[model samples]
Target chain A: MILAIASGKGGTGKTTVSVNLARAFDSEIQLLDCDVEEPNDHLFLKGAPTGREIIGIPVPEVDEALCDGCGECGRFCEYHAIVSFGTTPLVFPEMCHGCGGCTMVCPVKAIRETAKPIGAVETRRAGNVTLVQGRLDIGAAMAPPLIHAVKARLRRDLPAILDAPPGTSCPVIATLRGADFVLLVTEPTPFGLHDLTLAVEMVRALGIPFGVVVNRVGLGDDRVHRYCGQRHIPILLEIPDDRRIAEACSRGGLIVEALPEYRGLFRNLVGKTMFRTNPKEA
Target chain B: MKVAFTVSGGDLAAPLDSRFGRAPKFLVYDLDKETFEVVDNRQSLDAAQGAGIQSAETVARLGAKALVTGHCGPKAFRVLRAAGIGIHYAGEGTVAEALARYRAGELPEAAAPDVEGHWA
Candidate 1:
């Protein structure tokens, strides 16, 4: 089963839950870091780089020689990536979504596809886990395309865990797509609860079965639990507001390895999450 | 020469909008004809992104010789430069006053984009 760990607020510990959950499993698993803008899972799950591939998206390139300046390409683009003033259409590579709609709409066929490198995905073998992380280029606004590239490397046979980016934006949606289940990690603060509500709405809209993992439980009030309980959302696990976990995380250490006593919690998390996804299998 | 001034109201008397890309309207002043026209720019104002590019295309298509705004972004600057429309700096005045400043050679031509993209 493919499980995704996501949070609506940054610093809510989505990466912490993802890495620890992967380590909880004794068997081999695949972990994908879909937060291309700032992928930090590799720092905890260190391994020699096994493979690397540059990710690119198709952007339109207009040929002035064959162009008729029909202004059709500009009208076809929704992002305003291409614009024409009764002359040659200008192409802005950064705004292009690589939809190829402009190229198809061009009557004179002056537009052609060109590859624009946005980021790179690298594969690393971290013990029994095969970690895949995508790193977007600096100043590159396209994170969804790079996230899709990292997800494309998923090995279907092996159980996969995706560490998604924060918030209910396009990048987060891209990471959560096609997952068997999602683990929405959040703290107990007001900011956490507010964003969690938005995230819950997002997952519900996508029609994906998901559960909540309340991290740093003692850090704030019981609003998160109260909110989840009222909404009938399952509280799969809760990690206390412990300084040990924080120190371990700061040193790029996995909680399961640093604190062996906490291994059982994450181990139980795997079982509970799998059972949530498939009641009969568990 | 037709010059475009980013404005916030319907006529030449409207306040000059400080923002160029997301300005509410553009006052196209025809210096030769001594007349002006107001072009609504609500489309660029509501754009999620690339408002500057769209605004530049609009001013260029309207045959503006220069754009007078409080600020200009890199993307809009490039497009305006490509269209041979010079961007000039003028703020804290009405559209008609800005146009007068342009004709009087008081408004300075922007050598480069005054601010980064997405500047408010």
Candidate 2:
């Protein structure tokens, strides 16, 4: 089963939960970091990338010598990346969505597909967990495509935990796609509650089963809990607002390794999550 | 010679539009015939991206030799320059006043794009 860890608000302990939860799993598991714009799972889970591969989309390239400029290709592109004024079409590479619609609509067959590099995906191993993350090229506007590349590394044999990006945008949606269960991580602050409501609405709309994991429990008010209780959303686990945990995280250390006491907490979290997802196996 | 002015209304007495890509209307004037035509630019105003490019494409298709506007972006400047259209800047004035200034050779031709892309 694939579980996605997501938080609509930025900096609410998503990576912390994802890495620690992966460490708590006694058996082997796979971790896919779909935050291509700013992937930080590798910082905590230090391991050399076992394999790296470049990922890109096929943008269109127009040939000037083929025939007359009918402006069909430009008219076909919905992104307005290519446009012609009864002359040769001008292509803006950054705006292209790589849909290849222009090539199909070209009557003269002058447009051809060309590869444009967007990002790279790396596979690394850290003990029982295999980490796969996507790193986007600077100035590239295509994050969803790169997120898809990261998800492509999911192993069917092992249970996978996907760490999604912040917000209810295309990138997060791409990561949450096809997930068996989603763990919405959030803090108890007002901002957290507001964004959590948005996330809940999004997940509910997608028809995916999800639970909330409240992090830094003592820091904020009880509004998040009250909202969850009123909505009947399950509160699976809560991580206390402890300075020791923050200290460990600041040093790029895993909570399971740095503080063995919290390992039991994370292990229990895994148990409860799995039991809810698969009652027969549990 | 044909000249296009970015305007806020259909008539030449209307205020000159300060934006190039998101201009509400464009007035194309024929110097030889002393006739004028208004080209609606509402489509570019609502474009998600490349609004400047779309506006430039329209101006080029209209066969305008010069463009008078408050500001020009990089993409629009490139397209207009490629079409052999000279870009000139005009201060806060009506379309008619801007045209009069152009006729008197008071406004200087822009050497490059006055503003960055998506300035408006």
The lDDT leader among the candidates is: 1
Clashes by residue pair, model 2: none
Misplaced by over 4 Å in model 1 are A275-282, B32-35, B108-111
In the range A17-131, model 1's lDDT, one tens digit per residue, is: 9999988888999999999999999999998999999999999999999988888998889898888766787888999988999999998889999999999999999888899
Colliding residue pairs in candidate 1: none
Q: DockQ of all candidates, in order? A: 0.64, 0.46
- Candidate 2 docking band: acceptable
